[model samples]
Target: MTTENLLVELFVEELPPKALKKLGESFASQLFEGLKSRGLVGADETVTSYASPRRLAVHVCNVFATAPDQEIKKKLMPVSIALGADGKPTEAFKKSAAKAGCADLIEKWPNAEDGPDQLYVANDGKADAIFLRSMAKGTSLLVGLEGALEDAMAKLPIPKVMTYQLEDGWTTVNFVRPVHGLVALHGADVVPISVLGLEAGRMTQGHRFEARVDPVALTNADCYALQMADEGAVIANFAERRAEIVRQLQAATAPLGLKPVEDDALLDEVTALVERPNVLVGKFEEAFLEVPQECLILTMKANQKYFPLLDAAGKLTNQFLIVSNISPDDASAVIGGNERVVRPRLADAKFFFDQDRKKTLESRVSGLAKVVYHNKLGTQGERSNKVELIAVGIAAMLGNEKLESAVGTAAKLAKADLLTDMVGEFPELQGTMGRYYAQHDGLSDDIAFAIEDHYKPRFAGDELPRNDVGVCVALADKLETLVGLFGIGEKPTGDKDPFALRRHALGVIRMLIERDLPLNLDALLFVAAGIRGFSEDVAGQVETFVFERLSGMLREQGYSAQEVDAVVSLKPQRLGEIPKRLAAVRAFADLPEAPALAAANKRVGNILKKAEGEMGTDVAPDRLVEAAEKALFASVNEIAPQADAAFESGDYTASLQALAALKAPVDAFFDSVMVNTDDPALKANRLALLNQLHRTMNRVADLSRLAA
Candidate 1:
């Protein structure tokens, strides 16, 4: 048989560019799959997806011209249930039996002597709507493709689906936008299908400005793409359009003493903006070049879609270029229009710079408190107060008096620009604006830097604190946020982190680990206790919760979860020292003889977990064990304090070193003496030794379960 193609077009009002491709792809694939599973004949297939920022269409070829005959599942009721005890047809089963075209046909095919078999035939009809409805009923016991396809369309995935239309506008379907009509045909025959209220037809319109409505018929499977091409449309993939834009942009800018700006994202954004890609060279005032290149570039890219260009030395070239759908001759006019559009944006930047410089940055500081931070979290003024408090505490701890004011000043106006109209409109500049304002006011460079750097590393793999002042204020900012939220019992739960406590915690981690700063969570909590509104219990709970974030962070860094648990199990108050301790423990753990020593540590842990709140610091070593056991106990007594000293001082390497001293002695004791010895006094002494090791090891990290 000669191959025949099928075509469909859901003409719509202006559709969101982002959603057009997604909806088109989904409709084509889902419809194709649905038809295939129904045993439809589609010898070869291709789906051409195209849109014009207004309409989306999927043209399928060599697609099912008609459904193929196949066995279908049919359901039958037991005749015994269908008939009444009086040998009369029951109304319950009679209606359904009649609809199935088998009124009382069940009597001729009675249920077997045993009982009903409960089998079903999904569809038993000619290839058309009647068959589709039958197949739509769930064939599988569970939800099959029927529900999946419908559900997939229920909440159309991708952008712009949110702006639902009140009336089923031009699209003919009630959707996020108004629809126009549906054009569909199968093997030159119109397939009866309705999508978004648009009925199947064989005609499609093209380029609202370029072509008229035409009844273009797809000839063959391969003709689909070329057919759409003739309709003032390119039915090729989006990636082709995306790449073509880049190539043309480069070529257009090549002779203009400029080069296309290297920006993949900007390219992607531009691609979504145009249907037929064309690059047009444009020019701007060379005098505007006196302004910073970044400001000028931002103006063109953000406001005009005109990509800035640079010469050999990377100085801003007065000319810029843009991509438009029109021809080269037409684009010259478009370029002129874009260049004219960007002039005002550049002028505004220059004016803002001039106006900002008229006054000192100090004058902007007063504007900070007026800025609202959060509805309930008070103004930036209140957050400023918390930031200053934290900075002061950290400064004193670091013994850096110079950093105190810089840190405090940075904290004071960290959010100063939130009050500025610029930052209000462009929130990304909150910290950066504050830094600019502070520097303009003639504040010390360090404070200005801190103001800007405090929010560094906003997301994963971002830059972190770059200076002592920045680190101090950064830690304070993150800690205060974590504490304030957790105090109110607003912890992050699976996929819902309204407060972004995890990022704040990560910032804290990167600051400590990357900067190698000495910090005590206990000390940090004590400072957090100063937040004023928090209760003592709330303060403590928030503190523990933040500590858990650290624990989880460490575990993710390839440390054993059990190893982290061991150290945290010690009622940890100082967590900044944890990573170092874990590293040191991990290092010592890798020693060849570490397993037995780890076993000793695990045995020690088992004793403590089994103690079930039985014991305290009072270990009765007066009840001595055998001489060898006594020697091991003496060694533990000596090294325990050394380990404690190192741990308390945050010298975890030293702590693990001291703890490693016990490995040999403990290994010797396990080999020579049994803790469950026949003598009660000896057993008690060995138990005391185990407790001593547990307590000492607890100072650094719970090494018992640490993986080598």
Candidate 2:
């Protein structure tokens, strides 16, 4: 067998910039996997992916020219059906052998000793069957590569497909972009494959305009990247190009004592838009700075794919960096072209900003009525009212009338930005624009920031609200969306979260746990449910959904399943207390008596559950006849007050530590005394004692969950 490195490239029109990275990775991996599965490549072979604005390619090392031949077994039929009692071929056997194209081989099987290798009897699970053994021919590189190419193309994650006619003008093909050429080479020889109506060749275009040669010709798989760079003026590797852009951006900005805005998404998109990156600085008029820096920076990054520079104080500068595909001498034209292009975009943003400030947020509050929030949940105006009510109630619970007034005003104006021209133009600036407009209306910073911060912690790991009023409004807004949506049976199923309900639920969880707010979870859900007049059961369902999200979050934070189960099984109302409780549970588990105590606790719970009547925690001391039971009762009496006091003082660790003293007595009582005694009075007293012991041990967390 002979092995050689292989290379494949698809030359096409520009690919979708946002999807280029994934497209390249998927194409390379899928092609490599396809070859490996067919035994044409070894497990340790290396693969490199190349993606540019106009090409997708891959290079695989140590690929075999043909897969090795394999031995195959084909089951014929049961032995009973193949041969008669005297061991002669039956009619059924002849028909099956004829259909298998082995009738001539089967005729000599009984007497010819050399034909033994062709047919044999083997158990095919249920019965002994006659099997035909044969050798399969190896797959040549040409056929295998064709199948692999077809498989890779079929599995591409194309965002959209385009239908275009080939050069013949009669045949059409569907692809992400119109394909002009394909290069498939095994070593120096073309592997002869066709895809998307294009034939394999060594010639490929490069850089559109900056290439030193008209058509770059690759020599071998190993030299493809080097030749492309030297002759085509293009960097073929996606990651390499991105790193070069990053390096150039740093070099361009370092001398100015500033840095480009660090956004990986913007960097990737810009990297995908060009093949040979040349970083250059461009500037806009100082008058555009009057508009909010967010609007200016967003327009530059989102619309023009430019990297906006920021000063040392984190303020947007007048100059931004451009990643041009061509590096020309005296590059003033490229710089001037970009600057001229961005001036109108900035002017449009400034116009929208100026127009939005004319009407106050309070004045626009009524305009939200015309905007439909959800078909089932009335309009944005109605949703705003619900959020305001929940916010005011939360503020009152936290304390102070001034805070309640601020939260109510913030909630009312939060959705007012939806009606603004600036926000309507850029929906990402919804909360951001509200803050500016609120400040423009001569409102206090508290109200202004709250109106903006109400949407804080919008995604995972995002910052929470900055002020107390913002906290209340944020929680109220998220809870209203959660409960209202769940009430309408729009719950997320699997990955189909159209409304991002899971994100909303997680936001609520983060605020509650991170802020350590004293509000109860159930009570807050009830307040959020009140606006829609939803039933209590709906609120309970929302609570369960929130706890599920919290449980997953805790596990991700490195807590064990048992530890999380112990704490969350109680459904503690105050989510803020969970961290302290988990810490206490962890500390209790480290004690020497923890294992025995957890087991005893589990036993006690099972006994209490099985008892006929309701078992009260009140233990009658006189009825404690056994010495072990009496000692256990005394231990519980002594430990209960200490644990209860520590729990009240918020020292959960001390509360759990106090229960370690009862382990010995509890173990001895369970060892000697039967909880279900013959005498009814004795049994009742024992059950009550065990009930008290269970309650004292599980205050911080359910100890029974840790029994395993």
What are the candidates' C-alpha RMSDs? 7.7, 2.9
Query: What range of 10 consecutive residues in model 1 has the weakest lDDT sum?
Result: 127-136
Query: What are the lDDT figures for the candidates, one per model?
Result: 0.65, 0.91
Model 1 TM-score, all chains together: 0.75
lDDT of 1 by residue, 1-708 (tens): 343565555566766654555666676676556544643435356656655565555555554333443444455445455557985557866676667755535454333222222222233342211111122221330122234234435555555444443344433323656666666555556655555544556665555554423545555334545665566554244566787887887787766756767877677667666667777767777777765566677667776777788898887888777777665555556767777787888778767656656765556667667868676677767877887898789888888888887788778777666666455545656677667777778787788878888887699889986688888888888878877777666888888998888888778777766776667666776786676366667667766666677777777788887767766666555455566767777776666656766777787778667643345444575676467667777887798778778766778777777766777778777778777667755566566667777777666666666634
Scanning candidate 2 in windows of ten residues, the lowest lDDT window is 109-118
Error of 2 at 148 (Å): 1.3
- Residue 168 in candidate 2, Cα distance off native in Å: 2.1
lDDT of 2 by residue, 441-528 (tens): 9989999899889998888889999999899999999999999999999999988999888888888888888999999999999988
Instruction: Give residue 284's lDDT in candidate 1 (0 to 100).
Output: 73
Error of 1 at 351 (Å): 2.6
Candidate with the greatest TM-score versus the true structure = 2
TM-scores for all predictions: 0.75, 0.94
Model 1: how far residue 705 lies from native, Å: 4.9
